[model samples]
Target chain A: MSRALLEVHGISVVFGGLRAVDDVSFEIHDREILGLLGPNGAGKTTCFNAISGVYPPTLGDILLDGARTNGAPPHGMARLGVGRTFQIVRPFSGLSVRENVIVALGGPRYRGNLLRSLTSWRKKGIADEAGAILDRVGLLDVADRTSGQLPIGSLRRVEIARALALSPRLLLLDESFSGLRSTEIAQIEELIRSIREDGVSVLLIEHNMKVAMGLSDRVVVLDHGRKLAEGKPSEVASNQAVIEAYLGRGERGNVA
Target chain B: MDYFATVATLIVIQAIAACGLNVIVGYAGQISLGHAAFFGIGAYASAMLTTKAGLTFWQALPAALLITMLLGFLLGLPSLRVREDFLAITTIGINFIVEAVFIYTPFFGGALGIGGIPRVVVMGGRLGNNQFLALCLVFLVLSLALCRQFARAWAGLACFAVREDETAASSMGISPVRAKLSAFVLGTGMAGLAGTLYAHYARFISAGDFGFPVSISIMSMVVLGGMGTLFGPLLGAMIIGILPEIFRPLIDYRMFIYSVLLLLMIRFQPGGLLGDSSLVVGLLKSLKKLVKPKNIANPREIGGDGDV
Candidate 1:
């Protein structure tokens, strides 16, 4: 097995009196595709938030390449090579599709120094880089269109393109398949496979069981803020606890 | 000609300041209701340095700009903790506090403003009204170029990203706090530049000159011209700055008409006159259609408008 790229060591996130994620732990090896599955409100996104540095976990540590990085700011996490897509897609709506990707492409360089950013004449290089990423995600055709006017499928691709611009070692995709047509879903799955082939690890939160099962090498199921099952896709699908957590105990007794 | 030149000079100066404000309000998506405070600071800094410290106008200009920018940085620090309406309210408070400081501080002349500000001496003689207008025109051009550069550069893109979605921007490796701070510092520094020019040109200064009303007027220029676009604020300043002089015959009703016009603009064209969906764009599009050949089709139309 490849060395672990990310290790979530018993993290808990509390919101007021509610423990959104409680003592949940998992690991993703380098070049691995790990599916994070849960029912609605099962703390999957909360876990993503914690790992991506949106908020610090109330307890435990998140090690990225063996370095403790629990409470770093989101941009700091991105600088550390952690890219992410939101559940509801966010594109710089007023900007062109190419410009949205360009913003992400130039983020790290321009975020710190104002004078260098203002005087820099790297427009041609950045535009070429953005075009390459957009072409990778098959959005090169409508690269000049305003992002706000794009449909759901294209918007999702834009989000992915923006994330890819970060050159992340770990990609966190939150519900990228939701609201996409089957054809789009297949295209996205192909893209994810290619991303893994490029040696980038992926942590995907997916509700489409078949796609998730086929795509991920390992699957971790979360039920009520706890890790219910973590193993190979086939093994976790057949686990009795996971079945009960999904279908409830009264209906699926002894079925697996 | 003299009246026209003076009005034009004031319009150009206001436009420079409005362009600065647009960097914050239009591009970066932050509100600053206390911009006049920075302007006042610049004016007073230049005034005190030249009058009391016996420094040349050239020497004081850079000092005033740096002082205003440093204060702008301090002002931007609090913006990270507050957002939107709260940020607007905090800026309003800053305006009031700064005004109080100006009115009460002994060094700032305590309500009786400093006077006898030295004029820009080119070679041997002081600049005339016409020459001064020419100088202001040059600054206006520089301000516009600066704004254009910012809009196209990496920092500008970061500002737009932060404006669109802060969380999404951060996840993409852009720091929201830094983006906001840069906007604030640049915007306030521009306002200070305008203030410096105003003090020297008018050869007088006062707290009432940089009051809340002046702040509102600058904001209205940006909003009326179209907030985010390059030429919008300039157009806004020209119209707003000249309207009072145009309506001088009915001076009492001038403000009423101005208020009515702004109300109508907000109601009918919230995007301002130069925004993407503004009337100007619509008119230009129709004009293009009218001038185009009837037989030839637009390539973009053949491509089905680039929609899904």
Candidate 2:
């Protein structure tokens, strides 16, 4: 219905002789949520890495806002409005929660020019902005606490908050729901919905079937590094190939 | 009095240089074993500018800073590509190469070093030892202020982020290259400032003064004082700089003592004396517990014998 915020066109990523992700294509429109589903070692994370510029694709192109950005460095991609989080949380453990967000806020300022960065007053303004973002992410109470001391669920929120600090047009969340409690998952799902409501498109890699099906506007499944299926939840659920991929060939006939 | 002033001036100079090294090693989490090379470069550049180019000491100061910082930027560009131990080895190699250049290059005085460098001239008069000490103190304060500002700045935060995780830092849009290069450029620039002051104050220069040993000594000052803390380098410089003079009788065992002290620090207190989790604070807490027993019923039981 809207212009695509991100388009991954026939992208393949190969590490040495192994094709980690082979010729996968997808599109996420403005304010849309796209769930990329796969079994373990299905190259889902590799695809995310290629799109987020961690590893440039061995073939094909990635377009953000219709601009070719397949080979930019990770930070270059971030500055161009592609934000991301790791599957394993990476928090600046020594720094406070607020400071972690502040670091991200300062990133788009052209490597923070020496003169401007030296000004102490600007830090106050940036801290205020960090506080507001922390408030939005519900991390305000523990803003001064070191991030390393935070629990896993809070750390996941910190990862999300840090990515949100980039003010990205496209947010690539790699397994944000894993290792979270059921309540935490519900909260994160609501947070993701709000983030999309605020006009940021989301591309999430999820292992949880029900949540992925419930949350994503569209879903694409990968099996053995190849696109297995793509459609709405109900349509994709009844697809013979996806059933066989998930439940095995003999059990597919029993699914009605 | 003059001897005390000289030792104080030397301490101040070393402290300034240590502060610079801390910015790179402490804040940015980059190990540089070639910091003394930059210091020597600053000293040499200032000395040559004043003696050969006929520039005033004041003029040579900024020129030396620029020269040293430029060299730091160039060196940082290639070294930043490597991580951790490889980067450390690269810096160690740089120290050796730079020392060799100073020794063999006739333009750098070929081991003898540049001499007859002009001193600070104030109000048409050469500054006395005390006055020179005062000047160095002023510079030390300036260096400390610069370091404090850097610690509070966004660039410093970026350095911390880069230190924590380069991939995450890049994902957040902070360039690891920029964070590290700035640390190098600023750190080496401060080293240059210290060198310029040292050259003018000492009234002579020698290639042996800025060799690998000096680099190790500066690094020790940062580590011993508490890497990343503002006052840590100053404290470290005081101890390391004054120890030799205080223990002149045992000068032969100087390196031995230093090695022992460093070993103890690393093993017992890796955070250094002033770092967040320092031994000093741990000792203080234990001392407090000893003095005002936390459990009255078991005052003599240090381990809270009956609580469990």
**Candidate 2: Cα lDDT at A251:** 48
Give the Å shift of residue A118 in candidate 1: 1.3
Candidate 1 residue pairs that clash:
none
lDDT of 2 by residue, A102-218 (tens): 888886553546688776634367788888999988899999999999999999999999999999999999999999999999999999999999999999999999999999999
The residue pairs in collision within model 2 are none
lDDT of 1 at A72: 98
lDDT of 1 at A4: 97
lDDT of each: 0.90, 0.90
**In model 2, what is chain B's TM-score?**
0.92
Mind giving the per-residue lDDT tens digits that candidate 1 earns over A1-256? 7999999999999999999999998999999999999888899999999999999999999999999999899999999999999999988999999989988788666656767788543446788889999999999999999999999999999999999999999999999999999999999999999999999999999999999999999999998999999999999988989888887766545543
True contacts kept of each: 0.78, 0.75
Winning model by DockQ: 1
Two-chain DockQ for model 2:
0.60
Mark the 10 consecutive residues where model 1 chain A has the least summed lDDT. A247-256
